[model samples]
Target: MPLLAGAATVVAVVGAVLALADVDSPLRGPFTLFFLLAAPSVAIAAALRGLDPFGRLLASVAGAITVDMLVAQGMLAVHRWSVRGGIAAVTALSSVLLLLVVVRRLRGRTASRRTS
Candidate 1:
């Protein structure tokens, strides 16, 4: 998971830098999607492997959503919103959902153990 997170971070940084440098490139769209989407998913996945799962999940979700919203609003303000923005939002939300599932599973296991 840590390896995945590191890879995702590197990808996100590269994408973000590329997008910042050339906003009109065809590749920018996909890279932006990757940066905006995969980074948080990686963070959440890594967090699930540690303690304080709920806190980490919430922090990841909040940070991801904040970043996504800021980028979306910035693009919208500049009248540059596009399908890529939608893709980013969906991807981030999906990642958050995945994290929620992991958290729920962990909670269930703990509860079952306590009851047993």
Candidate 2:
């Protein structure tokens, strides 16, 4: 799972670079889609970390798609639909979600240590 996350992150970074550079490469479209979806998927996985493997996969995919659509609609509302905006929105939301996951995990550990 970590390997999958890492690969997705790498692809996302590459996609962001391609988008920011405004490259005319053939791979740009697919890579951009990867970038848009990858971070949210990772974040969803983090949020559902306690779930079983199959449940986690299903939840992550659904959550990622939901996040993507919300971001897209938000961009459309502001009339700023661009690759950079898409990437930024995904990255920001994912960061927040992952941060929440870390905070929750840390609090859980601290509570356990206290109880012990």
Candidate 3:
């Protein structure tokens, strides 16, 4: 799980940089998608870590897609459909999700330490 999160973080960073650089190439779209999806995918996977491998995979993909659609819809409704806006929104959402996971893990560790 930690490894997955790390890889997702790397992909997100690379994708964001590529998007912001305005790279005019065939890779831009795919990288942008990776940037948008990677964090959410990690977050969802982390949150569902107890599930069987196949179930976890399915849930993570569905959750990530749901998050992506919601973000895009929100942007469309508010008329803020620009590359910067999209990047910012995806980053913000991913950050929040990752933070939640980190906080939960910290709390779990602290509680275990206290019990020990």
List the lowest-lDDT window of 10 residues for candidate 3: 5-14
* Candidate 2 Cα lDDT to native: 0.86
TM-score of each: 0.39, 0.87, 0.84
Ranking by lDDT: 2, 3, 1
Model 3 accuracy (lDDT, Cα)? 0.82
Off by over 4 Å in 3: 1-12
lDDT tens readout by residue for model 2, 2-115: 998688778788887898899999888888888777778878898887899999988898889999999999999999998777878888999999999999999999999999
Best by TM-score: 2
Worst 10 residues of 1 by lDDT: 83-92
TM-score of 2: 0.87
Model 2 regions lying over 4 Å from their true place = 1-5
Local accuracy by lDDT, each model: 0.69, 0.86, 0.82
Can you write out model 1's per-residue Cα lDDT over 1-116, one digit (the tens) per residue?
99986877777767776665656777777777677756665555565556486777777767667767776787788998976555555565656767787788899899999999
Cα distance off (Å), candidate 2, residue 35? 1.8
Candidate 1 clashes: the total is 0
